[model samples]
Target: MSNNDFEKVIITIKVRGSNEEYDFEVDSKVTVEELLFKFNEFLSIHKSSVKENQRYIVMVETKHDFIDPTLTIEEAGLWEGSILILTPV
Candidate 1:
């Protein structure tokens, strides 16, 4: 198949304020916004009892490039092992 999406990718995420890092396995076709939403949901569930009304932007940790939330992981040129930083917008 020519599609690269549908496959799993391991993304390492670092929140802007905190030094703690998290790794997630997500579908390559998922949009950046969706991933952020999921990550936020995860945080709300594990760390706190209530969800925060916050928005985030994803960035390439090494390159310092801001990724568009509308773009899919593959479209963003993210590979199997990608490091990302989440910053509040």
Candidate 2:
């Protein structure tokens, strides 16, 4: 794997309208689909209230734009300290 594949970025993820925030060190090359999967995994481990069927959309907090799940983190324009929001879709 290339260095980019293993590169990590710190991002803040939060559920919409909730003050609770999660900090994750994610592989910079991760696709949005993978990121959502990771988010779900995190929720399952930390916040059990999230149901299996609960769908989420990831958005760049500052830009307020939904990220394309087909794209990798670098392709999605994510960087260190970027803030993301996971809202129910």
Candidate 3:
């Protein structure tokens, strides 16, 4: 693959309220916003639907710092093996 080819990495996420581990495919160029969107989609389909007025939280590498949902995943500096915790309200 060329350097310009999009590289995909797998991120592991543990969603609140469930014991199942979620694995997500993310492109290297994806932004934080795209990550959240992908996460939300994963929740809605593989896990549960995002409730109204519920706040979704994303934490990287078990760090307390939270990434804004509006930002793209790529902007969040997500890499391979990045752990994202999804807390649903």
Query: Model-by-model lDDT, in order?
Result: 0.83, 0.84, 0.70
Residue-level lDDT of model 1, residues 13-63, one tens digit each, is: 888888888888989899877888888888888887434957877889878
Highest TM-score scorer: 1
Q: Which stretches of candidate 2 lie over 4 Å from their true place?
A: 1-5
Per-candidate RMSD, Å? 2.1, 2.1, 3.1
Poorest 10 consecutive residues by lDDT, candidate 3: 46-55
Cα error, residue 67 of model 3, in Å, equals: 1.0
Question: Local error of candidate 2 at 19, Å?
Answer: 0.7
Which window of ten consecutive residues has the lowest lDDT sum in model 1? 48-57
**TM-scores for candidates 1 onward, in order:** 0.86, 0.85, 0.67
Model 3 scores what on Cα lDDT?
0.70
